[model samples]
Target: MDLDQSVIGLTSNEYVFEVERRHVGQFAAAIGDDHPLYTDEEYANQSAYAGLIVPPTFPIAMNDGKTEMPLALDQRRMLHGEQEFLYYKPIRIGDRLRCQIKVSDLYDKEGKSGKMQFLKLDTEMKDETGELVCISRMNIVYRSLAN
Candidate 1:
């Protein structure tokens, strides 16, 4: 299966998410991270951040299915190729974030099983002040459609 090359450079609509305490606590609990910054508000307030802060990986949940490819995708044949994140500032509770995803690259390659399609997505997030907070790059691999 071949991916639509035209989708490269396309960007999805901006998504706005307001960080909340519950969101932070739930994600921390779900990931089994009991760090003070993620769970203890008082401890975090005494630290440099001055309040509750989310775990580094918490942005994964901020998209809320809003980050989508312009073309259709088959979940059964899709695989997580890789994920990379760069954080500029700590995400704290009550911070409003503006986010968007862009299709950075797409290509096909020959695999042992067959041909595979690769889609690279870059998600950029900024704070209410318009300062960049984090950038996440995810690569999705699609196996050839079954006969």
Candidate 2:
């Protein structure tokens, strides 16, 4: 197994994101979720929700502040190995949020198929009150034939 990179932790491009009403609405529409909890405020209020709520997967709908991924890895054999999301609080509209993102465990391996890069990314999103709203983890596997 060969290691492609030695990145230690979160890089300079890691960042947070805030969800807005417009972005939530667009995401809801794109995902075909029109439930009262995601759309109509009155209906949401009657359903025990404080206000308009985005779908459970709404956290990823917006581009947010996440950017500047490390380009050191080979892209020809890139693949998403796994993904998971954990929510600490219910995401509501008009809530300004801050996010922290970091990269962890950068390594590589050589298998019968080819060369593969193993990477783990952690993203944390918090509300203005400093309460964690959501955290998403992404595992990416990159396949490339090293020279």
Candidate 3:
């Protein structure tokens, strides 16, 4: 119903995932990306990456069930508004990644449809070497059921 400012800056539980070549290939295929870097191990092994590299948005799978808001928001009324990713380095197979979700911001506005609450979340992914691999920013819109 209303934006909960108290939940801003709240951090969720950390999740660790071990990237595998099969998963990377599957994700690339699911996204309709036919790049050799992602689908061809022999090609990737000869390229600059020297190994299988995951797609840019592949981190979504790694963060699955890893993050959550600190509030009790209605899941049925929530909409995925936007998503962005910033990568410091490429994610390769065999790397262990750690991801954590943080509630970055929360706000409410009156829209043509109705009053909408926006929740911004940031998920940081880092490798086992303590280097940042990527940062994903996701915005979710919570619409009042009455609207």
lDDT for every model?
0.85, 0.70, 0.83
Candidate 2 residue lDDT tens string, 26-99: 88788788888977878888776677778887765544544656445556656789887888877887776676
Positional deviation of residue 57's Cα in model 1 after best superposition, in angstroms: 1.2
Model 1 error, position 68 (Å): 4.7
RMSD of each: 2.2, 3.2, 2.3
* TM-scores of the models, in the order given: 0.85, 0.75, 0.85
Candidate 2 total steric clashes: 2
User: Clashing residue pairs in candidate 2, if any?
Assistant: 16-99, 77-143
Q: Model 3: which residue pairs collide?
A: none
lDDT for model 1, please: 0.85
Over 38-139, each residue of candidate 3 has an lDDT whose tens digit, in order, gives 868899999988877888888878855635655667888889999998888888888888888888898999998877888988888898888899988889
List model 1 lDDT by residue over 37-82, tens digit each. Answer: 8777789989988877788888888876755655677788889989
Worst 10 residues of 1 by lDDT: 64-73
Measured by lDDT, the strongest candidate is 1
